[model samples]
Target: MNESIAIAWPTDDELRAVGETKVLFGHQSVGADILDGVARVYAGASVAAPVIADVSSGEDAPDGTLMHACLGVNGEPLSKFAAFAEMLDTPVAEGVDVALMKLCYVDITASTDVQAVFDAYTSMMADLEAAHPDVRFLYTTVPLTADRGWKSKVRALLGGDDRMGPADNVARERYNTMVREKYAASGRLVDIAAVESAGTDERSQDGHTYHVLNQSLTLDRGHLNEAGSEAVAAELLKTVATYSPVA
Candidate 1:
């Protein structure tokens, strides 16, 4: 993981000239804010392009995740859709150490077919890892179910329409469990979902028990409250600190 892999980043003006780059930035208080908070907590570590992929499909587009997206490297422009391969081809970049990035939460609950999601992610990860030996991608778990009304719970229990409920939580934990089983020791994952559910409650649905978000940690279903963001940010910092380059 060379600290000096300088990417050919573009200036703010250059980015403005292109239409594609405009859409990814300017989220007032969402994913990027949390990562920014994490960077602030770890004195020596920093987060760059704390943004989500502007591209719509996670499975097909390199821009589907922030790590895969072509981001404004240190507020300067690089190629619009430069993925990890592009980063590895050039000299070391300044904004982010291309060696590692947490693949931001992809909503597994959105897909009942968790195996397919994992298969796609695994396929993407394997290629990236194979091509860029210097790079390590960190996987993260989905946030706990924050939309747990009894009606929704019942709906989820039935396995029909509820996206966030007891069964959904079970899915979250199941996938997260697999992640830990596969990646924890190697430092390929940072379990932000664990922090999000710290001291959370457990409820049963159709003989399955799963975790729910502590109300303190959520603004609503699938959204983080201020405390929630802070907790996640700190945990992310802890993970970054472990593998961060020594100053």
Candidate 2:
């Protein structure tokens, strides 16, 4: 499978910094893939990887460990936002250096109101920023589902729903555009959609081409495979390694 840009391994100092950075990640299944990829990344570097712990709450998290947890129900974007906020109220947010919450592909559908969702997201993030001034909040684009294959297309033609197709990805792109516009310039964004779709697959619909999850990277319709996990985890680590908290 074609990869994106070459993985830039952090220097020993930066690696140590990554290990020392206290990060809280709220996500669903795909988040697990990224975390697995993180382990692969550190293993490839031949260094002792950071402590990764799955905790029920922030109070259980150890200092300097990358504590991750599943946030809210899938397909309910607002719930995820609220869950992240609730997570911040715990001790994890007290001295956290970096944190992010990611929405799964099922969170947004073709009929979703992108504007409304973006508005809710912005309000929640702004509040979190004000409440946790010491922590750096990272924004993530919503993940994209894979495009329909020829067989799936045939099924769709025969009146079967393709589950998630290009139309749903279009909605995700709309939200991703908002995220990039708000944070890309400030360098506080992790463009997961971009990484997943990079140099991989594009589906043209209504005379417009939209990036979709690289089929090669996914075993299912949405979740990442090993290669996909490593690809995204590399970017995630690079972002955390290079991040500088604002004074």
Candidate 3:
């Protein structure tokens, strides 16, 4: 939340000069307000949502600005990334300048080899950068969470998610560390993990990563509460303004 010390944010004049940059934010429930937050933090100079109907993520692509159709018209997430990608192939997103592919909860709790996962992620980013040479492809960090206790089991019943426990937290940290060190590690990436900590949770070795405080998360043990969401939103604006700008 401290913008002054943030390593790479753009000057207000530069951000304003860039005008309204269209950004496609591929995310889950926690990211719902990110665009709106960008509007609030940047005020008149904002990162606007892209034209979704024209994007093409996959073969079953919809015809129009269908990115908004991923969840139907009801605001639910339907195969989120797949749909987002599918729509990007369409014509509506031709002018999109930036894309944030939000990693899923499964990536954090799947209990997989962190290195292998990060390697695959790096490859994916490379591919994206190759495919969309003009658009800025930013790597995003997943938020840290406390042990969900019985809530983990509840998530399993609803769908499938690994329990948010010591081992899972370790994996999450490992992945995030790789993201920071291997990726730009600066303003080019959206450091969701670095910003959500409220100084109330346990810290990682670097001191920037912290588990989500109970106050910052809903009972699900992973999703961001209003305060957490707002904090993240502010950081996201800084990240975009600092790195992905109008050319």
Candidate 4:
């Protein structure tokens, strides 16, 4: 990480705005990491953080809370969409100012059909938006995995991009590109991938340059460490505060 470049933390007014917003987020472990960062952010600042709750379908969080749940099984991308749409159908989604679901890195593999995943996501989000016209649906890109080091670099040189690490990231990049193309102008995007890959040198192999999770940001292959978590969570809060919900 560059020590000279400063991260843009949420302003006091933005923090207050998000505090009053009722958000429903469906995600897996990385999402938990982000929520951890959210807590750290509020703790260090002079604002009261919103309530964070873990609830299931048919359960509703109190007003001014950020209600969240782990949705779908890993390796099953479509299931996440199904689970989130189902949640939107229940009372849990009532009066929600913002709602989104994030697909874990495990959800997309080298063999996964990125187009199919994108199609499912777009169709489901469209249905949910029509059903809950009052709620603003934020679209999130899938999280990314760190490059697998020497072996991954060699594979990139050999044009063997069919394995799990870099190839899977390629699939994820394709999906994220599609998402950005579709919703780039909508002002409802929370681009987790961009945050994960930022502030680091781009990795290149076989004359192709690509983005990967900044190794300094993770102790493991995919999950975020404290600093990484805080970086991503700050962007998330800042983005969430930009929306003015329909009155």
Off by over 4 Å in 1: 1-30, 39-106, 150-162
Off-target runs (Cα >4 Å) in candidate 4 are 1-5, 150-164, 205-208, 244-247
For candidate 2, lDDT tens digit of each residue in 1-247?
3444444456666666778788889999999999999888788785678899887554566666788999999889899999889989986666778999899988887878889999999999999999888888888999887767788888878978754877888888888988899989878788899888876756777775767887777878689988788888877877776773421
Task: Looking at model 1, report the run of 10 residues with the lowest lDDT sum.
Answer: 1-10
lDDT of 3 by residue, 1-247 (tens): 1111222334564444334556566665555644444444455334433233322343232321113222222122234444555556666556666666666444565356667657766766677678888877667876666555576667767865455655566667778878988775445877777665444456453333435434443435567654555567666655555554543
lDDT against the true structure, each candidate: 0.47, 0.81, 0.54, 0.83
Q: Which candidate leads in lDDT?
A: 4
lDDT of 1 by residue, 37-59 (tens): 43333333332433333332222
lDDT of 4 by residue, 70-109 (tens): 8989889888899999888888888889888899888877
Error of 1 at 122 (Å): 2.2
Q: Which residue segments of model 3 deviate by more than 4 Å?
A: 1-19, 33-87, 147-162, 201-214, 217-219
Candidates arranged by TM-score, highest first: 2, 4, 3, 1
Candidates 3 and 4 compared: the better one by lDDT is 4
Question: TM-scores of the models, in the given order?
Answer: 0.60, 0.91, 0.66, 0.90
